[model samples]
Target chain A: MKRLMAIFERDVTLAFRTGGGALNSVAFFALTVVIFALAIGPDRARLSESAAPILWTAATLAAMLSFDRILQADFEDGSLDALIESGDLLSLVALAKASAHWVSTLLPLILATPVLGLLLGLPAHAYFPLMASMVIGTPALSLFGALASALALSLRRASMLITILTAPLLTPAIIFGVAAANAGARGDALFGPALMLLAAMTLFGVLVTPAATAAAIRFNTD
Target chain B: MDERPADAGRLIAARDIAAQRGGRLVLSGVTLAIGPGDLFILRGPNGAGKTTLLRTLAGLSQRAAGALKRSDNASVFLGHADGVKAALTARESLSFWRMIYSAPPAIIERAISRLNIFPFLDQRGASLSAGQRRRLALCRIVISRRPVWLLDEPTSGMDAVSIRAVVDLIAEHCRDDGAAVVATHEPLDFGPGRTIMLDEAA
Candidate 1:
């Protein structure tokens, strides 16, 4: 447990350091939202109506932008080897890394969602549901994205491979996240079911991906 | 000096070991034993599989074929990469490793002082010279308190003084009943140890 916390703390510290991945991800998230608003033009109703999908898409892409470095940097620098030699279960290390990604990358994006919400003219009622969806849903992104990152470690064009490997797996979270937000926008009862399913997916990802990621990391390093 | 001992209290023993790199057999038909207070130096030309052999022993690479055994499973491996994070200061790196190993503060202080790392403790890994980075990486081995050390080119970029420090550290480690297998091109004076020539292993 102490070792796991050490891994988590170190990764989060690294993420917040100068030129770290956290800032880049948040910038990418905000920029992506702004670009979508501009491309779709200034029609308020249209912007509000498309807001949930746009935010979810931008968040997903921004999450991917940070995923590539999660394990690749450690692998490149030989920290992965050191961690493996530390005698802690690799799955616990993977879990710590994924948790750090969630905290350093996804949490900041969630915090910025409100501002981006205002920019997109997201319906006032939908804000809570959108944030809640991301809060519950994005762990899946970090977990599975970390799995992809570990699987893609040491490969050339690894980021591209991470995106390709992670996109399909994340589709369900986007579907459920966008659905919950839209339902909240309409003040409908469907919000409950959509959010529940989103939570379920995130919970499942939390349970499973770390071990698989550990296996991938071991294979790659070998 | 080259005779194998009968199996008794060996820290590590491998017979007819083979290791592959990139699906090609790079090292094969190797046999050796390491016991407490042992320091085995591996020497070979480039591509002679010295790194591969160290990595295989460290369990970082799969052994293609071998009967390998270890009396104790704990070992620390220092590879070519220093494993220092560019964004982290040297002190931060040491503290982070301290947490990973759950090492006592006194041990960390000893490592920092022994490696002469206090002068650059606040410098980020990106700014540290090669020798400094190597020193930081070596601290992990001390903090680890593992029974075996597998080091690949540990003194690669050190000046004479730093090299002497590392040699003393390794000697101290062996004197404390720890075994070390160091693979290096430069001849280091690790007193009273066996040498494994990888070219001869092949």
Candidate 2:
């Protein structure tokens, strides 16, 4: 737990203090919402119906943009190797890193969703579910994204490769996130697919990605 | 020479450890036990598996054919890269690592001061020279107080003064029952040291 906290805190500190990683995500989220609003014209009713999917899509893209830098910086600087040698539980370390990523990339986007919703003509009911779904779903994005980050650490074009490799895997998050938000907007039970698929993705990410990342770092460092 | 018995005071144990990269055999059937307080220096030419062997022993790389065990989990591995972030100051980098290793604040303060990096603490790592960045990376082990240190090309980019500082730090640690496995091509000339030539295994 201590080591995990250490990794988590380190990532959080880096995200906020050094890289300005969080701000970039927030800016992307805000800019994307603005451009989207401008492009769609003044048809408020159309925008309200489509608001949930649009907001979710923008948030997902913002999160994706920030994921590559999560592990790449650490790998480049030798912290990853040092952490591996620390004899701490690798999964805990991975979880902490993912948590930090979520806080930086996803948290800001989720926080900005209400304003975004208003811009897109979403009602209070629609906006609330969109925000709730984002809160539950973005951590899974962070988890799976970390694997892609680790895999692309040593590549010449890691940023671009991260998108190509992980975007396909992120299809499930998009599908379920859109469904849950839509259901919640329609006054239906949102717990079924929204909660289940997010939980499943979180489980798979926690169990599988860390070992692969640890192994990938081990292979690449040599 | 105070020869800590390799069998009795083993810091690292590898059995039948082999590694491959890009389908090429890097090392095969390699086995060794390094004792406590031993400055085990690795020597080999480029592409000779020196870095691979060090990383595998440090558990940073996959071993194709064997097992590796460490004593008490008291180890830190420093690779060829400086590992400092360009955006973060020297102090921030040290503090970040100190947190990761769970070292107390006092130890971290003492380490930065001891390494003469206190003056440069607020300077970004990107602004520092090659030697200064190396010093920043070394500070973690000093503050960590771990029982073992694993270094790959520790003094690769440093001048003579920085090299001496690294040697002094290693000697102090070994004197306190800590061990170090340093993989370097340069002559380190530290006392009570042993050499592991990869060509011998070849």
Candidate 3:
């Protein structure tokens, strides 16, 4: 438990440091949303209609910006080897890293969703659902992103590989997240089911990604 | 989860061990044993599988073929990379490892002083010199309190004084009944120990 906390604390501290990449993720998310709004013009109805998908997609892409570095730093510097030698389960270390990534990178995007939603002209009714979806959905992003990061560890052009590998896995979270927010915006009854599915995806990611990530890291290190 | 007692005689033993890197055999037909107070030196030319053998003994790489046995004593591996985080200070790195190993604070203090790390304790890993970074990484071995140490080129970037400090540290570790397998090009005096010639192993 102490070891896990140490990993988490160290990762979080690194994420906030210069060249840590967490701030870049948030900046990318905001810029992507703003660019979409500018490209879509001042058609409030059009912006409102597409708000949920735009935000969800931007969030997913932003999360990807930081994924490549999540385990790459540790792997390159021999920290991963030392970590494995620490006698703790690699799965636990993976969990700590992913959780830290979520907190440092994804959580900021979720927090900024409200402001981005305003820029998108999203309906007030959709606000809660959008934030709720982000809250529940981004963990899946971080979890699977960690897995992809580990899979691509030490490879040249690893960021591109992480994107290609993670996009397919993240489709479900984006789908369910956008669906939940759109349902709320349309005043339909689908929000509950959509949010539930998003939560389920995150829960499943929590249950499975750590071990999968550990296996990937083990393979790469070997 | 080997249930053997900590005081078991042998630390590590291997016979007919074969190790591979990049799917190619780098080392083969090796046999050795390590016990308490043993300091085994691995010497070889580059690409002669010195690093591969250290990594294999550390269990970081899979052995292509071998009969290996360990006595449940935890071993620490220090490789070519220093494993220092650029964002963290030297002190922070040691404290973090100390926490990970659940090592007592006294050991960390001892390591910091013995390795002459106090001068750069607050310097971030990115700013530390190669030798300083190596010293910080070596602290993990002391903080780990593990009986067996697998070190690769531990004195690569150190000056004469730092090298002596490290050699004395290893000698002290061996005197305390701990074992070490050091792979290095530079000669270090660890008193009495066997030397494994990887060129011959290959």
Candidate 4:
């Protein structure tokens, strides 16, 4: 518990204290969604139809933007070397880092999703479902983002690689997330099943992300 | 955990340990032993593989050639990067490390005063000078209370006073039955420590 809190507290403090990356995530998320809406020429019907998937995609990319923040700083600054010296500590740090990333980056976007929802012509019916699906799915984003951070720690440029690799992996979460929100807005009966799968994906991430990320970090330590 | 007793009655041995970095063999044919109350200095030229040896000893990297053995307790690695985040205050950073190391709170106070970091404990890492950052990084040793310290160029970018303080801290840590392997080009005033000099890299 102390170890987890140590990582969590410091990350949160830095996230708010610097006031850059966290805000940038929300801004990037909002901008991407808005631009998509505008680029489609402000047709409310088409905009509403695409809004849920676009928001989900924007959030995923924004989460990736800050993926390097999870372990890159530790790797570059040699903190990860110290933390990973202990066999057990690396896994704990991985879990703590993923939790911190969600709290710092995704929480803000979830809070701001309603406004972005309105701007993108999301129907009133979709607001809660959008928020609910994001709440369920965004943690997976942070978890996989940590995994990507570890995979890319030893490389010079990794974002593009991360996108190519994780896009196929994240497809299911994105599909279920968008399906839930779109169905909720359009009063389709698949909403409950979609949301259930979204939540299950987040739970699955909670179980596996730590070990995967820790192994990646350990590999990079060499 | 392993339930092994702490650093007491423990020894770390390296026999013909070879290390590589960036796909090139840097150091080879090394042997040493570190026990409680030991102060071991790694003296070599810039490319003599001092850092690589330290990393191998710390278990941060695998040895390419021979075997390395140490106590069940892990050694702490302090590298050139200070590990101080620019957004955090000195005190906050120390507290964070304290929590990570599972150290007592008293160590934080002692380290802060011993290093004379109280003047800027509340200041952000970005606002500190290079020497100050180095000093803060050295404090992690005091905070960790770990049995073994693998320090790579620990005193770089520090003034005379700061260097002296670090030397004293290491000496004090040794007196407390702790061991240290410090990798550096410059010699420090740590008393009675054996020096392992490395020749050209292989």
Candidate 5:
């Protein structure tokens, strides 16, 4: 627990103190939404109708942009190797690093999503569902992103490889997230089931991805 | 020297080990019997797999074929990278590592002062010199107080005074029943340690 907290705290501190991690992604997210609005032109009905997919895609992309940096920084600086050798638990440290990434990047994006939604001319009703879906769904997004971050270690240009390798895997979350947000926009109860599925995906990623990442890190650190 | 009785101390042993990196064999038929207070120096030409051997012995890398044995739980491995975050101050970085190793604050304070880093304890990692960064990394190994210290080129960037300080620290660590495996080309003052020579794999 002590070691895990150490890993977690250090990552969060670095993310905020450094200019490039969370805020960079948030800035990218808001800019993308603005560009998206200007490009599509401001037709409220058209924008609200398309808000769910646009928002989901933006969120996923923002999350992806932060993926390659999370574990790779530690790997590059030799901290990952030290952590892997520290004690008996590699998975715990992996989970901590992933959690830190989630908190630093995805959590901020989720907070900014609703405000960005207003920019898309999304109706107030869609707000709750969008945030709800992201709250549950983004865990899986961040988890999968961390997994990709680990796999990217083996590649020469990890950032280049991250999107191509992880985008397909992220499709289910995007599909379900858009579905949930749209249903909630229509005041339908189907959003509940969609939310549940999203939560399940998060849980599955939570349970499985850490060990895989730890193994990949150990293998790649050498 | 295998002259002493084998059962006299703590042991971490690797036998008939082979290792490959990037699908190419880098080291093979390597064996080592490391125990407490052993300051083993690894000497070799560049690309001779000295780092690979230290990493393998530190349990950070897999050995392709090896029977390994160990009775110690505390081992510290220091590779080329210092693992300092440019955004974090020296104090924050050391505290974070202390939290990880569960080492006390006094140990960290002592290690910092020992390395003459009190002046820059609040300096960001990026602002510190390479030798200072190396000192912070050494401070971590000292704070870890692990029985086995595996350092690769630990004193590469330090001035003579700093190098002498590090050498003294290693000697002090070994005096306390700790063991160290150092890979370096510089002549060090560590006393009467067994030396290993690694050759580039065929």
Candidate 6:
């Protein structure tokens, strides 16, 4: 628990203190929603139906903008070498990195969703489920993003490469996020698919990301 | 996590280790033992497999088949890259490393201060010069409290003061039952250190 907190604190510190990656995500999120609003001008009825998915897509893309922040920094700075040298659990290290990425990149997008939803003309009933789904779901994006980022760490302009790889992986989050919102807007229970998608992503992220990252680090370093 | 030996504070032992890169054998039948309080230098020209050998010793590569044993509680490796993020301040970088290193918080601060990086602690690592970045990499040893330091080109870029500081820090680490394997071509001054010519092995 203590070690996990140490990792968590470090991630949080990078997200809130450094402020570059986190702020960029927020700006991207805002831009995405604003552009979306302009593209589909003042048609509340049509926009309302697509609000949940659109908000989630924007969040995923915004999160994509900051995918390489943690691992790439560690890679360039030699901290990744230290981590590999220390004989610490690579899984835990990956988790710490993933946790930080979520806090910095995805958390802000989730926080801004209520406002973004408003821009989409989402009813109040849809807002709660939309926020809840994002809270549970976005960590997977961070985890998978970390994996892709680790895979491309040694390549040129790895951040963009990571973005390209991860955009497809996060499509499920958009699917479930929108489905849950539309279900909520219709006054229906979204607990089924919403919870299952979030749980599946979390489990997949936790189970697979670390080992992939370890292999990627070894390969890149080699 | 093996127990330390008595009388022979050998930090690293490699027996007939063979390593290959891209199906090409880089190092083969290499055997050496590095003892505590000893600074071992691996001297070779560029592309002479120096970094590959160092990376193998640091456990960063599976390309090598070797058994390496360390007497220290932990081992730390500093690769060719500086590894500091351009976006994070020096302090933030140190703090991030501190968390991952499993060192006590107070010791971490002392390590940071020891590098004389306290002044520019808040500055982004990219903003710092190449020499300062190297110093930050060196600080990991101080923070790690590990007995074995595997350093690849520890003094790539530095002024006289920073280089002296590195020498002093290595000397101090050796004095305190620590050992280091430094791979470099440049002449280094670590008092009473041994040089293992890697070129002679093949």
Q: Give the TM-score of each candidate.
A: 0.96, 0.89, 0.97, 0.94, 0.96, 0.88
Off by over 4 Å in 2: A189-222, B1-6, B28-31, B104-106, B200-202
lDDT by residue for model 2 over B128-174, one digit each (tens)? 98888888888877766777788888887788987987888888778
Question: Which prediction has more favorable DockQ, 3 or 6?
Answer: 3
lDDT (tens digit, per residue) of candidate 1 on B104-167:
9898899999999999999999899998899999998888988899999998789999999999
- Pairs with backbone N, CA or C atoms under 3 Å apart (clashes), candidate 1: none
After superposition on all CA atoms, what RMSD does each candidate show versus the true structure? 2.6, 3.6, 2.0, 2.6, 2.5, 3.2
Residue range B1-202, candidate 3, lDDT tens digits: 2334432577777667899888889999877777879999999888889888878877788889977776554589999999999899998999999999998999999999989999999999999999999999999999999999999999878989999999999989998999999998897887888888878435
Fraction of the real A/B interface contacts present in each candidate?
0.79, 0.72, 0.79, 0.77, 0.79, 0.66
lDDT of 4 at A137: 85
- How would you class the docking of model 5? medium
State the lDDT at A176 in candidate 2: 86
Off by over 4 Å in 3: B1-8
Worst 10 residues of 5 chain A by lDDT: A151-160
How do the residues A137-176 of candidate 2 rate in per-residue lDDT, one tens digit apiece? Answer: 7787888888888777788557777888889988788888
> What local lDDT score does residue B129 receive in model 4, on the 0 to 100 scale?
93
Q: How well is each residue in B133-176 modelled by candidate 4, as lDDT tens digits?
A: 98898888778777888898888998998889888888888899
In model 5, the Cα lDDT at residue B52 comes to 84
Best by DockQ: 3
Residue-wise C-alpha lDDT for candidate 4, range A1-222, written one tens digit per residue? 877887887787677777438888898999998788879886888987888898899988888778878887778777777678643567778998889989999999889888988887888888988888999988998888888888888985677777776776688888999999888777889989999999999999889888999888878778
DockQ scores of all models, one per candidate: 0.77, 0.56, 0.81, 0.69, 0.74, 0.54
Provide the lDDT at A70 for model 6: 67
lDDT value, residue B14 of candidate 5: 76
Residue B21 displacement in candidate 5 (angstroms): 2.9
Candidate 5 residue pairs in backbone clash: none
Clashing pairs in 3: none
